[model samples]
Target: MSKALTSFLGENLADLKDKGLYNIIDPVEGPNGPIIKIGGRELINLSSNNYLGLATDSRLKEVGKQAIDQYGVGAGAVRTINGTMDVHLKLEETIATFKGTEAAIAYQSGFNCNMAAISAVMDKHDAILSDELNHASIIDGCRLSKAKIIRFNHSDMEDLRKKAKEAKESGLYNKLMVITDGVFSMDGDIAKLPEIVEIAEEFDLITYVDDAHGSGVLGKGAGTVKHFGLSDKVDFQIGTLSKAIGVVGGYVAGKSDLIDWLKVRSRPFLFSTALTPADVVACTRAIELLMESTELHDRLWENGNYLKAGLKALGFDIGVSETPITPCIIGDEKLTQTFSQRLNEEGVYAKSIVFPTVPKGTGRVRNMPTAAHTKDMLDQAISIYEKVGKELGILA
Candidate 1:
């Protein structure tokens, strides 16, 4: 390494430390679930994205083990070369059916899916109207597309309409697309998809919704598109198997042509190795479970509601969240970090989110109550929150 580069990195690292923005990773000692062990202590985990608590489910593990026994552990090569397995096709088919689309394609991760799909269609000649609060994957994908990115205020239909009109009127682009997250992760807010679809229709723009956090949460586990009954109207529905599905991989559900085009053009799909057979099988089984019954989803909602009610009752400022994601807004970054630290010390595993992940001075500790969390667990978390809030002067 160059000495100059090393010096620059050292300076930047020191700056982060000085500002109390440097984070030290805390390792989870066991399986991630509703409750997790960290640093030899078990805590009620409200920081995980495993919405349905499927990450540690024994059923998924059995399916994964069976696939491994049958097909081994790896895909061996990229899909375009020789890696496409029967399980991959089956998973895609399952995703298509779940999203009510003609076809679907899977990628290594949700982030890779966005990076691949957005650039596959939209290019330098195209313009993309994107939500300001879209996931980082979407932002990176838009950048990779080399398109003119027009940002609209988060969930602001009027701003989206204004930007859409401007982009359409300029005639400076060959294609126009609007993209947003189906459910924002930080604030746990649902996107205004119905209004967005109406705007897309008026502007003749292709619509895309990344439902990474929505799948297995909204629409009885079908997703936000299905939740809003706009499955047939949205052009692209992106989802992940990592969170609620308790597996790994990302997929894009859309018309057959779009899937076909992505298979041929998406660099990640063409060059990166496909998902392992076990992952594909486990993901398929997870979807099957979701379709079979709404028990898990309903339980998740109950847990979410319980936690939200408990938090609000404790006099914490829970933001305007319409989903299982509840945020305790603490404002200052240092205080938010301290709050999270105290929660962990008190046997509650809620993580603090500060600037860059969220807006400045709006730092919060996001709580994700999964289906596996019992009422007693939530009650304990609320008690801990109250204690921490009082000690820190956050609550009267």
Candidate 2:
């Protein structure tokens, strides 16, 4: 490597180290469920996004194993060549049916879906109005689109309307699209999809909702668009097969023509290998389970409410959350990191999110309570929280 390039990287690493911002990766020793084992110690896991606990469900595991038995391990080539297997088509169809859309296309990841879907339609002459606090994937996707990006305040429909009007009034772009996360992961706040739909309709802008965190949590397990009863209004409903689905992949559900266009133009879909047969099968079966019953979703909500109520009763500030995602807002990045370390040391594995991931000094430990967590586990976690809070002088 060149000396200058090496020097620049070294300086950046040194800065991070000096600020105590460089975290060492800690690997989980076993399956990721309501509780996980790390360093041979079990902990009440509040850091995962597996809301429905499908990641450890026996049904999904069985289906995945069967797929492996029948189709082997991997897709041998890119989709455009010969990797589009029967399982892949079934997954796409299942996702479209679940989202109530005409068709769907799958990508290797939710991030890839954003990169593929956004750039496939919008270009330099187009404009995109994105939520100010949308997911990083959405931000990167918007950047890749080469579109004139106009950001609206988080959950502010009026701001979205104003921006949409400005973009349309400019009359310089061929197309205008509005994109947002269906559920804000940090604060666990559900997006104002109904009002966003109204603004999109008023301005005749294309609508997209990335429901990665909402797919198995909202709409009795259908998704955010369905939760708001706007399935037909939103042009693109993007979601992940990871998390609640307990597999891996991302999908975009929309009009048949739009999906067809993506199939042809989305670089990731065309150039990347299709999902493994096992992953596709597991995802399809997970969707089937979701459609068959609302037991998991109901249980997840119950656990979420239980944990949130318990935490609040102990005097810890759980930020504005309308959903199961709860955050213990601990200001100061260093303290937040220290807090997470304390939790882990105390046998609770909640991770701290700091600046760049969140705004400066608003660092927090985000908790994702899932259906698999028992009441006893939650109670224990709350007790641990109380001990930690008092120790840190965050509570009485």
Candidate 3:
């Protein structure tokens, strides 16, 4: 490697480590359920995005194994080519029905879906009004589109309305669109979609919502757009099969024309290999399960509320999260890292989030309470948290 590249990497890595911002990953020894094994130690796992615990469900696993037996290990080609299998079409149809959209198209992953969908629709001649707290994929997608990106304050409806009106009245762009995450991941706050839709209608701006964290946790498992009753108004509803669905891939659900256009213009769909047969089949089955019953969904919320109440009662700064995603705010970076380390050592695996994942001073240990977590597990986790918080002087 060149000396310049070596120096750059060494300097940046050292800087991150010195500032307590570098992340250390732990490999899970078994299934990433409510309990996980790291380095042969069993811990109450609060770090996974497996909200419904379907990642280890026997039903999903059985179907996936059957699919692999039937369709081999991979799709073997891109969607526009020979990769679009019958199961792929079935998953897309399931997504469309689940999202209440006329049509939908699946992609390799959520990040790729954003990269493909955003750039395929918007261009240098257009403008995109994005929420300030949207996921990094949305940011990269907006950049890839070469559109003028105007960021509004995080969930500040007045700010969004003002920006939308200005962008619309200016007439500098041919098309205008607004995009946001249905639920902000870090803070776990629900987006102001109802007001956003009202403003979009007034300004005639296209609406896009990426409900990666909201699906299977909100809107009765349909997602944030549906939760707000803006299913008919929002132009693009993007979701991940990886998160709540307990599978791997993503999709954009919308009108038939938009799906058709994306099928032709979206580079990822045209160039990248399609999802595996097993993953596609499992994803379709997961959606079917969510549509058929809310048992898992209700349990998820119950655990979430119980955990949040326990933490808040213990004097931890549980932020204003509206969903199952919970964050215990620790203001100092090093202190936050120490808090998480203590939790891990005491048999919990909630990880720390610091800059640049979140702001510098507002570090946190983000907890994800899933449907599979029994009250006994949560109680033990809370006891461990109480002990750690007291030791760390984070609680009185």
lDDT top scorer: 3
Off by over 4 Å in 1: none
Residue range 1-396, candidate 2, lDDT tens digits? 999999999999998766657766889998998789998999999988888888999988998899999999998888889999998999899999989999999899999999999999999999999999999999999999899999999999888888899889989999999999999999999999999999888889999999999999999999999999999999999999888887889999999999999999999998888899999999999999999999999999999999999999999899999899999998888888888899899988899888778998898888899999999999988988899989998888
Off by over 4 Å in 2: none
Write the candidate numbers in order of decreasing TM-score: 3, 1, 2
Score each candidate by Cα lDDT. 0.94, 0.91, 0.95
Candidate 2, residue 100: the lDDT equals 95
Position 146, candidate 3: lDDT? 100
**Quick one: how many clashes does candidate 3 have?**
0
> Could you give me the TM-score of model 2 versus the true structure?
0.98
Which of the numbered candidates is closest to the native, going by highest TM-score?
A: 3
Superposed by TM-score, candidate 3 places the C-alpha of residue 113 at a distance from the truth, in angstroms, of 1.1
Clashes of each: 0, 0, 0
Query: What lDDT tens digits, residue by residue, belong to model 1 across residues 1-396?
Result: 999999999999998666657677889998999889998999999999899988998999999999999999998999988899999999999999998999999999999999999999999999999999999999999999999999999999999999999999998999999999999999999999999999999999999999999999999999999999999999999988899998788999999999999999999999898899999999999999998999999999999999999899989999999999999999988899999999999999999888778888998999999999999999999999999999999999
Cα TM-score per model: 0.99, 0.98, 0.99
Instruction: Give Cα distance to truth, residue 8, candidate 2, Å.
Output: 2.0
Tell me the deviation in Å of residue 147 in model 3: 0.3
Instruction: Estimate the lDDT of model 3.
Output: 0.95
